[model samples]
Target: MMTTMIRVVLPAHLRTLARVESEVRLDVPLDAEGRLTQRAILDALEARYPMLRGTIRDHVTQQRRSFLRFFACAEDLSLEPPDAPLPDAVASGAEPFFVVGAIAGG
Candidate 1:
């Protein structure tokens, strides 16, 4: 197994909740057959920062929170399958995975 560094950007509220001022850097474990996906990233994020465990995803179902959105390489990844491999740029750390808070108003 090997570890790869992944960069992540959290929304302001989440950052405050996690007590982080800058982008988060996580060392994600990768096996020979493991593909870099949203599920993998979220698992690593919650593992490294337990405070964020249920913040981004449901603890039981592991589903993304409804009020949050995900993005990578300037594309909306919110509706993508969690197990699908993220963009290469994101997996390579060339682009940061983004979690943004969604706001709805009339």
Candidate 2:
């Protein structure tokens, strides 16, 4: 069965590191009931953007790496877990998923 598509936007440094110019799009891995989860979305995103390998998660711990953020529907998802469910708009392809590198300074 076909599923909806989600657009993932990456930060500039990540884009340069990944050597990708356009936004990354993925198919929501839907279940029998058509429910889509963040884990599924992230898995697909990582698979498609191999250069983004450790940019979001720690290569050793598999934990969320520092300086990365996830956003959708104007909500900041920097601290959200990998398995957290996203908004319906994002899951249903009405909105795009964002993975941005956090800025730091003092």
Best by lDDT: 1
| Global Cα RMSD, each model | 1.9, 2.3
TM-score computed on alpha carbons, candidate 2? 0.81
- Each candidate's TM vs. the true structure? 0.89, 0.81
Provide the global lDDT of candidate 1 against the true structure: 0.85
Which residue pairs come into collision in candidate 2?
none
Clashing pairs in 1: none
Worst ten-residue run, lDDT, model 1? 28-37
What C-alpha lDDT values do all the predictions have? 0.85, 0.76
**lDDT tens per residue, model 2, 65-96:** 77777788999976777666678888777888
